[model samples]
Target: MDYHLYPLGDQGVLIELGEDINLKVHERVKSVSAHLEKMNWDWVIEYVPAFASVAIHYDPMKVMEKEGDSSLYAYEIVCAYVEKELEKITPSHSEAPRTVEIPVCYGGEFGPDLAYVAESNDISEEKVIDLHVGGDYLVYMIGFAPGFPYIGGMPEEIATPRRKEPRLQISAGSVGIAGKQTGVYPIETPGGWQLIGQTPKALFRPENEIPSLLQAGDKINFKPITREEFDAYKEEEK
Candidate 1:
């Protein structure tokens, strides 16, 4: 796998693996994470993984001291290790994606843009639902908003680009399309993605043990649920 490692904000290193958001890239994410954890690097505070890259945070003082250099030799040290370790991935370092289920209410009040999306794609609303729920999506990375999974695997026919005029406030659970991708809103935030169906599920709640509904490299399957079921879930929450 081709990769590029760069120094960022003193102790941070950004590693770009590839351009495509697919299973292959997701595997690379897991591989890199494991490799980093096993390495005896000095004072790595955090490792943030995204769609095509990994951003590593470290303590500059500790790293420089350990490497016996006044300059940023620590960055070079880590980069060398990463480049050496990422050699076609060994059998022991095989990547695996975790599967997650999200139940959604397709049309009417829940999906305000359902008709619009259907109209844009030249298909019936029912077909739109089928096309949407049919694919198994991958969580490339979480960005744009907290716990907002940057999901991939939308059908080519219904990959509607973001709205020319974005909504002022898209409520939590609002599922949307932006260019070639689709995702759900973890919190109410202004966004340009074409709003379609919604899931009653709590995408992010700090109270839960797992605060983030979707993590990077997660596999997602959208299951169509009834409005009544959604209402019941809300009622139960109350």
Candidate 2:
């Protein structure tokens, strides 16, 4: 219910819901985003919801026309409209998040950092795998790479620090742990998170109606698979 609205240049406004990343903050952001989406206003171009903030991209000229004042500042006009809409929102009114399952082939060459993660945590490889899969994580935001999910709800037991020297090109579908969080790499990119596993699923598809397989406020469950099964899945895609 508590939030601050600030100008984000001449045609954008940022709504800060809170300082921390938690369900409460995310709920508020989702609610505001939903309401704004419903408006379908000409000025509103895109809505980018983050962990605790929503960045709204708008058309300054359209916003000024909508406000019926040519002299009105775009930021001021957009902020006023957003404030009015937000006043009616209740964070708890947001819809329930959908759940998705991601199958991963853990350890071995696909996950070079697996051994290091197990050793640093003082646990067996099997134990690390068990702990990692046992989690039901939440999708906080999608950023970094297209459709790359920033997830939460990782258990502390298997948490591992980022690599001291990041890899130049981590293969696509690599699942990794960074401090207290876990995520998947949707594309081949440089990263530092301790690699744990690789999934055969494609997290981003530009041709699909919904480009990103995951979105804000979704849940992900990691399922374990064998190397052979991983290879088979890849073959099926060919």
Candidate 3:
């Protein structure tokens, strides 16, 4: 349970579980997050889990009242409590990661930059798709846009840089690659990732209890589908 605590402004504490973004670090992050969820801390507002850190946002007023110490600042009080709680957590206690299947239809209209990605990697378009599908991926975090998953573990062979000019509007479920990472645009938004395919599945469902289709620490499997299959999947949704 090696970690460092940093003051996030005055009301939040950033708990650094590890320095690098690896499975080991991710486990610690998840473990800490799960532990926090089980605890009934009245002063805790919310907790955000990231690549190697978990940020806990708390209520300064509540912390001051709970501590009943005029000498100790709110931040100091919260940090001490967090540090003690973190000491009790171990990676082994973390729940097993969930595996999610993301079916993608590569190339053609769905992927405008498919050719570019293939050329840049010096491989055929089909090979590019094969490499992408073959690789195991993990949802590192959801960010940039609602339900957008920042996935990692892309095969190095198919790795390519983001486009110099970003597209004004990328349709939701458009799968793209940026550098060594891959992600799906959850909402229609402007982005620079190289579009390689699109998924008929909806990643963002605001009406649901959990809005994001994916979350941090989930395992991802990319399954390739044909144009006909993609259209059929879309039809089923409606």
Q: Give per-model TM-scores.
A: 0.88, 0.96, 0.96
Best by lDDT: 3
lDDT of 3 by residue, 183-213 (tens): 9988899999999999999999999899988
lDDT of 1 by residue, 153-193 (tens): 88888888778888889889988877778899999888787
What are the per-model numbers of colliding residue pairs? 0, 0, 0
lDDT of 2 by residue, 140-201 (tens): 89998999999998889888889999999989899999999899999999989999889999
Order of candidate numbers by lDDT, starting with the best = 3, 2, 1
Q: List the pairs of residues colliding in candidate 2.
A: none
Looking at model 3, residue 151 earns an lDDT score of 82
RMSD of each: 2.5, 1.4, 1.3
Question: Candidate 2 versus the native: TM-score?
Answer: 0.96
Task: Let me know the TM-score candidate 1 reaches against the reference structure.
Answer: 0.88
